[model samples]
Target: MLRKVALGSGVIALIPTISAATPVQESSKEPLKPPLMRLSELPIYEAPHAEYGEYIKSKAKAEKNSYLRSVIHPQVQAVREIAEIGIAHTESLLHTVQDNYHELRDRTEWIVQYLREEDNKEIRYGAVAMGGLTGFIFGLRGGIIRRVFYAGIGTMAMGGICFPEETKEIAKRNGALAKQYINIAYNFLYGVKPGDPQLEVKFPELSLPKNVSELTQLTINHWRVKNRSIASEKCEVECFEDLLFITILC
Candidate 1:
């Protein structure tokens, strides 16, 4: 009985030791907590096929391009069209202004030339008629003062008609003087310097004589020279005769 009790106590001590060792073995066997791995140490999963990754990338690119075409391209094109239209409209407006400016310049030149022509006898006749009509209208007034004014105007009209050549000479001198005064005024008011090259003075053509008799002689001499040149060129005799007739008439 004594040996049996000693053996049982020894077995009881070994049971506690085994129980402590069991917990240690169980903790160690619990996968070692994956060796305390860091996030970078972890294995990354790859696609099963390499082409599959390329296909996914390509599809994403295609979808992006499609979105650009559908959503953004139309807006860009519309903006370009609007810009082109605005440019064209601006060009058209500029052209219209240029055309109008040219037309107005031409009309002004025509009016100036018409007023400057000394041979426009209609202007003198019209002036005389206007003066006569004004005088007649004022004469109808009852006062002696108005009668005197009307009589003076009638006498001036008669003098203008009777001495038209003298009147024209006086007018030419006055017009030239007035032109100088006008130019002076224009330069003073518009900040234009004297002797500016842009303000060119146009002299009358030397070839064209102002007097009718001198102009007729010049025309006859020109025709004679031209006929001689034409005769040297073997022109027809009938044509030469016709030209001589025209020259004589001129």
Candidate 2:
């Protein structure tokens, strides 16, 4: 039987509440800025040392440990079983949530962008049609007024539909990632002041299945999916250190 010291969840403890690896919603009241190219438009950053170091090292080492347990030395596994399970669970959950959200968020943003462009085209055509129809029904003078009246309303309606309100609503209703991240953020908003994410070592009796080798493969699958799909091209933090830690947890 293996017993392991639980590694503290570096992320859930040190990061911000919003570190759930999800997107943040844009406030409708906020004026539109440059178009969002990626979810990084929200506040999220990568830890310089932590990103390449413990994060990856821990994961890779765990993978190595898993392999060793299955193929080479099931005996040593008795020493560090619980910690491995917790690490895999923690990393897999965060990375999977974040990577999955990133893909969906990017796709939604692009769809909104396309619909807005299409809306502009429709407005232009509607205006042109109104002018031509009015000319056919009334004299040139009446046609001009009618064109102005009807075309103005048509354009305004299209503007309303394609502009901030529609996009904002769509982003709101469909923004599952933002909601999820926000929930995570709330937990961290107050910070690790609450204490570290529960470490498994605190309860050595708690252990994962004896057949743990398969879990390693499952976690690797999650990591690969996250790497392939999720992207965070930008982030800004009001508190650099806090935010960096938060990003790790996220």
Candidate 3:
């Protein structure tokens, strides 16, 4: 119980920062554009076009040997499949949640119309009428019909006040779940636990406009190779701090 209390307090402390990032300001900014070709984008050029053209070509060609798959073990394949499934599922849920919001708005319009019939008066007068009608319907500690009417009016008014927020909350919840499935599934499959958790692998997301999906996928592949090289060779990767935002492979 004491541990739970501490964890709850820590989480509550984080609420402010989490909420701060999510406000409309984050969405209002324009996306940054890529300025130059990444290293990966450059072709394996001949000597005149590339400083180390011969070395680059021969190196890539050696790695493309037929026996290459022998080095890529089965476990890695399993994890890659899991990541692929997550990518598919998250994208699907994104579409579904987006659709549901539009449906909710349509339902809200229907409720508003039905509400018009229920309250013959305008909203300026309807508040008092609704309050009184609400009381009359439920005041007697009510009959079956009274309870239903009272609930309908109460639901109508409450939805008018809060349904938009509720709809947003629902969509947000679904989106979170979808992202969680992807993040957790990927981490569990790959065994590289998450430290700075964020929604990732947003399809086709890349700094460059052309071939964004391919570029991002290439980065993922490079990251995987870098990860393995580090593990097997005990080689520490240079951070390349200046190029942190840029793709290392490109």
Candidate that scores best on TM-score: 1
Regions of candidate 1 where Cα sits further than 4 Å from its true position: 1-56, 121-250
Residue 190 of model 1, lDDT score: 72
By lDDT rank, best first, the candidates go 1, 3, 2
**Candidate 2 lDDT by residue in tens digits, 1-250:** 1222233465446766754666878667422234434555544564344444656677789999888778866656754787798989999999999999999989977755764675566754454455445544554356666756665545444444456566446545645565556656666665634467722212134233345586787678879878765532222233666778889999
Task: Tell me the tens digit of each residue's lDDT in model 1 across 1-250.
Answer: 9999999999997875433444444353222123444667755683324445566777799999998899999999999999999999999999999999999989977854664457865775565566666776778866867766786576465435544567667756876886787767767777777666334344464553768799999999999999999887775777789999999999
lDDT of 2: 0.59
Candidate 1: Cα lDDT at 177: 88
The residue-by-residue lDDT of candidate 3 on 157-212, one tens digit each, is 54444343554476568667977788777767667655755445564533432476
lDDT of each: 0.70, 0.59, 0.64
RMSD of 1: 28.4
TM-score of each: 0.29, 0.21, 0.25
- On the 0 to 100 scale, the lDDT of residue 130 in model 3 is 66
TM-score of model 3 vs. true structure: 0.25
TM-score quality measure for candidate 1: 0.29
Order candidates by TM-score, high to low. 1, 3, 2
What TM-score should be assigned to candidate 2?
0.21
Runs off by more than 4 Å, candidate 2: 1-79, 118-161, 165-250
